[model samples]
Target: MKIGLYFGTFNPIHVGHLTLANHIAEHSNLDQVWFVVTPQSPFKKKSSLLDNHQRLEMVYRATKDYDKLRPSDIEFGLNQPNYTIDTLTYLHEKFPNHEFALIMGEDNLKSFHKWKNYEIILENHYIYVYPRLTKVKTASQFKDHPKIFNISAPIMGLSSTFIRQEIKAGKNIRPMLPEHVWEYLDEMNFYK
Candidate 1:
C-alpha cells in the first residue's frame, strides 16, 4: 500500500486541508493520505502554537468521515524539534510493508535542503509536491529530485496562523474551517 504523508501543525483542521488531502488521494497513485500532525515545526514560531494533542484531535474530527484521509499522531512519541527525515526513518522502520511518500506544497520544496538528512529523505522516499500560488523554483534547486507531483486542487492560500488570528479577533471562522471543526473550535474557544 502507498501512503502520502501530509505533515502539518493543523492548529485547526480546515476545509482547505481536507480538499488537498482528498485531491491528492483521488489524483495520485497513493491509496491514502495521512495527516502527520507535527508537535512543533522547526521553521515556525512556537509561541502561538496550541497543544499538539488538541490540534491532532481537531484533525481527527475533521477527517473522521473520510477513510482515505487519516490523522496520524506518529510524531507525538518522537523527539522534540521534529524533523521530516527523522519521522520518515521511524515510519519506514515501523511500517515496512507500506510505501511512504512525502506530501508538501511548492513552498516547502524550495526550503527542502535546510532539513536534517535531507539527502537521505530524497533518496529513500518519493516526494509528491502540490503547487501553490508561489511557484517555488524547486526543480532548479534540487537535481534528480524524487517523484514531484503538481496537483490541480483548489487553493485557498489559507494558513493555520490566519485561522487562529481570525478567532482571536472574534471573527467567524466558518469560512476557514469545516463545519464540524468550526463547531468544536467555537465550543472550546480555541485560539482565544
Candidate 2:
C-alpha cells in the first residue's frame, strides 16, 4: 500500500487540510493519507501549541469519516522536538509492507535542507509537495533532489493561525472546521 504521511500540528484541522488530503489521495497513486500529529515540531514554537492528545483528538474528529484520511498519533509518544527523519525511519521499520511518502507544502522545501539528516530523507523517500505562496514552483531549485515532485492543490488562504486568532477574538469558527470538529472545539473550549 502507498501511504502519504501528512505531518502537522493540526491545532484545529480545517477544510483546507481536508481538501488537500483529499486532493492528494484522489490524484496520486497513494492508498491513504495519514495526518501524523506531531507533538512538537523541531523548528516551530511549542509555547502556543495545544496538548498533544487534544490536538490528536481534534485531528481524529476531523478525519474520522474519511476512509482515505487517517489520524496518527505516532509522534505523541516519541521524544520532544520531533524530527521528520526520525519519525519516517520509525514508521518505515514498523510498517515495512507499506510504502511511505512525505506530503508537505513548498514553503517547507526552502528550509528542508536545514533539517536534521535531510540528505537521508531526500534520498530514500518520495516527496509530494503542494504549492504555496512565497515559494514559487521551480524545477531548478530541486533539480539535485531526486524524489521531490510538485502537486497543485486547491488554493486556500485559511490556516490554523487564522482559526486561533478568530477563536481568541470571539468570532465563530463554525465555518472554518467540519461540523463535528466545530462542536468539539466549542465543547472543549480549545484556543480560548
Candidate 3:
C-alpha cells in the first residue's frame, strides 16, 4: 500500500487537518494517509505541546470516522528531536512492502533544504505538496523536481494555535474541531 505520512504535533486535531488529509487521500494515488503525531518537533517548542498520549487520543478521535485517514504514534517511540529522514528510514525498514510518501504544505517546502538529509529523502520517496498561505517562495530546486508532486488541495487557513488560543480565552471552538475531539478537550479542560 502507498501511505502518505502527514506529520504534525497535533496539539489538538481539527477539521481543517481532516479535510486536507481526506482530500489528498481521495485525490491522490495513496491508499491511506497516516497522521503521524510527533511527540516533539525539532522546529517547535516542546513546552507548548500537549501530552503525547493526549494529543494522540485526539487524533484517533478525529480520524476514526475516515477509512482513508488513520492516526499514528510512530514518532512517539523515536528519539527526541527526531528528524523526518530518521522516521522515514525506520518506517521503511518496519514496513518493507508498503511505500511511504511525505505530505507537506508549500510553506514547509520553502525550508525543505534545511531538513536533515532532505536530498536523500527526495531521492528515496515522493512528496505530495499542498497549497498553503505563505509569503515565502519555495526553493527553485524543488519547483521542477520529479519526486515532488503539487497537489491542488484546498488551502486550510485554520491552525491549531488559533484553536488553542480561543479555547484558552473561553471561546467556543466547536466548529474548529471534530465532535469527539471537542468533547475530549472540554472534558479535560485543556488549554484553559
Please report the candidate that would top TM-score against the real structure: 3
| lDDT tens digits by residue: candidate 2, 22-106 | 8999999999999998786566766668888888888888888898999999887777676888898889889999988999888
- Model 2 per-residue lDDT at 100: 89
Give me candidate 2's TM-score against the actual structure: 0.91
Candidate 3 achieves a global lDDT of 0.93
Q: Give lDDT per model, in order.
A: 0.84, 0.86, 0.93
lDDT of 1 by residue, 32-132 (tens): 99999988756677777778888888998999999899999999999777778888889989999999999988888888888899877877788887878
Models, CA RMSD each: 2.2, 2.2, 1.6
Question: What local lDDT score does residue 118 receive in model 1, on the 0 to 100 scale?
Answer: 80
Off by over 4 Å in 3: 41-46
Best-performing candidate as measured by lDDT: 3
lDDT by residue for model 3 over 61-170, one digit each (tens)?
99998999999999888887889999999998999999999999988999999999999999999999999876568799998999999999988999999999998889
- TM-scores vs. true structure, each candidate: 0.91, 0.91, 0.95
